[model samples]
Target: MGAVESRLAELGIQIPEVVPPVAAYVPAVIDGDHVYTAGQLPMVSGALPATGKVGDGHGLVPPADAKEYARISALNALAAAKSVLGSLDRVTRIVKVVGFVASDPSFTGQPGVINGASEVLGEIFGDAGVHARSAVGVSVLPLDAPVEVELILAFV
Candidate 1:
């Protein structure tokens, strides 16, 4: 296995199949040396694991759960990148990450939620996973998913 794949195995993670797009766009596209992925939802077995705005309230998806969803979304984004690049080992750096959180009005923990994605990438890629990032709070997301993530990767 490639270095990146080995790391994933060490972390007990198996890169999942690229998520099929919900709309017209492709999952990922290559332009020059970078691979850009469509925003990915936290899908398991082709279904969202949870759906709701994230907040502290009882009816909202808790911040912790949303964080886990962010991780799953990041994995989906990685799958998209791999589909285009044919291997994650070609990734020289994680260039950028943009995370969207479906959030309640009172929620201000978007950054923490996105950390789930960042942390996992770091574990897999070490220093190469560090990147510029944006954590946005949106009132809603496609499929009402609690979190969504997209990635930009620089590859050989």
Candidate 2:
């Protein structure tokens, strides 16, 4: 296995299959030395684990749960990147991450939720995972998924 794949195995993570796009765009595209992934929802075996606005209230997805979803979304993004690059080992750096949280009006913990993605990337890639990021709160996401994530990677 490549270094990146070994790291994932150490973390007990198996990179999943690239998620099929919900619309017209491809899951990822390569331009020059960078790979840009489409927004990835927290899908497991082609289904969302949870769906709702994130907050502390009845019928809403909890922030903690949303955090987990963000992690899943990041993994999906990685899968997308891998599909295009043929391997994660070529990745030299995680250039950027953009995460979106379907949130309640009173919820303002978007950054904490996105930390799920950030932390996992750090664990998998060490210093190479450190990167610029944006955490945004939105009224809703495609399929009402609690969180979505996209990635930009610089590679050989």
Q: lDDT tens digits, residues 1-156, model 1?
A: 899998998899988898899999999999999999999999998999899999999899999999999999999999999999999999999999999999999999999999999998899899999999999999999999999999999999
User: How many clashing pairs in candidate 2?
Assistant: 0
Instruction: Tell me the tens digit of each residue's lDDT in model 2 across 65-107.
Output: 9999999999999999999999999999999999999999999
Q: How many residue pairs of model 1 clash at the backbone?
A: 0
lDDT per model, in order? 0.95, 0.95
Q: Estimate each model's TM-score.
A: 0.99, 0.99
Query: Candidate 2: misplaced stretches above 4 Å?
Result: none
Residue 54 in candidate 2, Cα distance off native in Å: 0.5
Q: How does model 1 fare in lDDT?
A: 0.95
RMSD of each: 0.5, 0.5
